[model samples]
Target: GAGVSQSPSNKVTEKGKDVELRCDPISGHTALYWYRQSLGQGLEFLIYFQGNSAPDKSGLPSDRFSAERTGGSVSTLTIQRTQQEDSAVYLCASSRFLSQETQYFGPGTRLLVL
Candidate 1:
């Protein structure tokens, strides 16, 4: 019954560096999603993966952002050439599917780019 989890909980990085954020989603979840939330802002969908559906990467901010999911359970988001504007909480969530069901979220990996 392990829930979603993210490492460090917080990260500080210099501008133009690279950072990798990890996410462990709940077991048996076939749908995984990556989202970003700025201070006081609503959640923005970044990418999503379902059982056999092609990964959706429409929300990726730019070329510097990429993500991959292995075994359909664990996912990692890598941000290259980090920018001050990238400072935000990178959140990961998973649900039975992207529908009426609620998507459980991890505590989040907070990135502070300076």
Candidate 2:
């Protein structure tokens, strides 16, 4: 089966413009995660969805950031107003089980706001 993948491997946009990044996880995966990583920085968890559990959005930086998973497979992260500070690699991961499961990561969607 296919592993996780993200679209627009790289993105460049002006401040205030909106952008949407997509992620496709492996089939049969029940847990999905979204994270952001600044250049040379570690990953920062954004949101996570597992089966019927309530999606965790605690790590979302601001109101401008949001995400949703459809049919527990593909997910999308949307930024309402692009900012220079938002420039980073957005990574997506998926796992079979929620606990102690190592999530597989995508190449990530790199965003650059100028």
Candidate 3:
């Protein structure tokens, strides 16, 4: 793809349900990140991955939210036992090397937990 792309542009799930959001980053990008933005709020970082390893996950709001990157490309964010607070736009971004570089963002997955 030309840039980062995410699957299921919109997802509606019930409370306590599990959801998996997928992101395919730009080719050759080494760093990937997961984020979420709630209504009327700033973007909140969730996780960061260098290659296939996640070194920074301090931003995760709860243990129910977990992410993984495989083959340094596609990444998945799994939200288990979703709650209304978890309803937000799940965003994915990728950079050339590290977090300091410019990041290309995907369209984002809109997750609505009711």
Candidate 4:
């Protein structure tokens, strides 16, 4: 199967707008994750979804950030009332079973909040 794919590879929005980023995981992958990387910073875990279990969203930076995975395959991350500090590369990754397994990552969506 194909690797993970994300829509809108690049986005530029106003400071007060909202944005939706989408991710399509590889087939049969039961674990998915979202991460953010700022300039000169390491990847920051944003959310995690595994099988039918509840998603671990503790990594979300604030109340305006949220995500959801459907059927254990596709996931979407939404950021409301974007700010300049929110500019970063949003990355999505998936694995066959668990977080400890080999994970495949997608080309991140670069978001620039003006």
Candidate 5:
């Protein structure tokens, strides 16, 4: 595959609504990650998945946020009960392995929770 691809590049939702963001990682990459970047802030790790094992979701900001990787290729992030402060660019990245190496990132999904 060329690179990671995210759907619905831009999303706008009313407060208290729910939304789902999708990511399609490059083929053969076994390590995937999700991150969020708020305006005027740095990227924050949200979750990570390695192979078929349980994802490392310690970085999720709250219980309202969740994600899942299906078949080790595509992943989706769901935000329940959205709030204005939840607006940010959700990013997805993937690497061949979970080692000290460079990771390729997607263009990111810009989410706006009004």
Candidate 6:
């Protein structure tokens, strides 16, 4: 797809399980970011991958949350030992560069941990 795309638009998992969410950003976009939106938190940044530089993971809530982008194109966010609090909409976005004014956002993946 030409635009950013995410797999498994909806995911339901039990607490203590692990889940991997995927994202495919627009071609040639050099900056990619992961975010989570929940009831308490409107929107929070999770991770950011820009080009070959080390990803900025300061936004991650804990060690259980991790993400990686390969070939500067596809990225994956993995949550290990998921908890009920981990349930939220995982969003992916990409831009030609971090300085770009406009970012392309994917249809987020809704995760429900029971």
The parts of candidate 6 lying over 4 Å away from their true place are none
The segments of candidate 4 whose C-alpha lies over 4 angstroms from its true place after superposition are 52-54
Flag regions of model 5 displaced more than 4 Å: none
RMSD of 6: 1.4
* Per-residue lDDT of candidate 1, residues 50-75 (tens digit): 85353567789998999888887778
Q: What is the lDDT of residue 30 in candidate 5?
A: 92
Query: Tens-digit lDDT track for model 6 on 1-114?
Result: 589999889999999999999999999999988899996677898888887454577899999998888898899999999999999999999999888548889999999999
lDDT of each: 0.87, 0.89, 0.94, 0.90, 0.91, 0.90
Worst lDDT run of 10 residues, candidate 4, spans 49-58
Question: Clashing residue pairs in candidate 2, if any?
Answer: none
Index of the highest-lDDT prediction: 3
Error of 5 at 100 (Å): 1.7
Q: List model 3 lDDT by residue over 1-114, tens digit each.
A: 799999889999999999999999999999999989998888998899999999878899999989999999999999999999999999999999994799999999999999
Model 4 Cα lDDT, one tens digit per residue, 2-109: 789998899999999999999998999998888999998999998888974545678999999988887777889999999999999999998998857998999999
Clashing pairs in 5: none
Model 5 lDDT tens row, 1-114: 899999889999999999999999889999989999999899999988887554567899999998988898899999999999999999999999888857899999999988
Estimate the Cα RMSD of every predicted model relative to the unseen true structure: 1.6, 1.3, 0.8, 1.2, 1.0, 1.4
- TM-score per candidate: 0.91, 0.94, 0.97, 0.94, 0.95, 0.93
Task: List model 2 lDDT by residue over 1-114, tens digit each.
Answer: 489999989999999999999989878889888899999999998988886343567789999998888887888899998889999999999999888998999999999999
Please estimate how well model 5 matches the true structure, expressed as its whole-model Cα lDDT. Answer: 0.91
lDDT for position 19 in model 2: 99
Give residue 107's error in model 3 in angstroms: 0.5
User: lDDT for model 6, on a 0 to 1 scale?
Assistant: 0.90
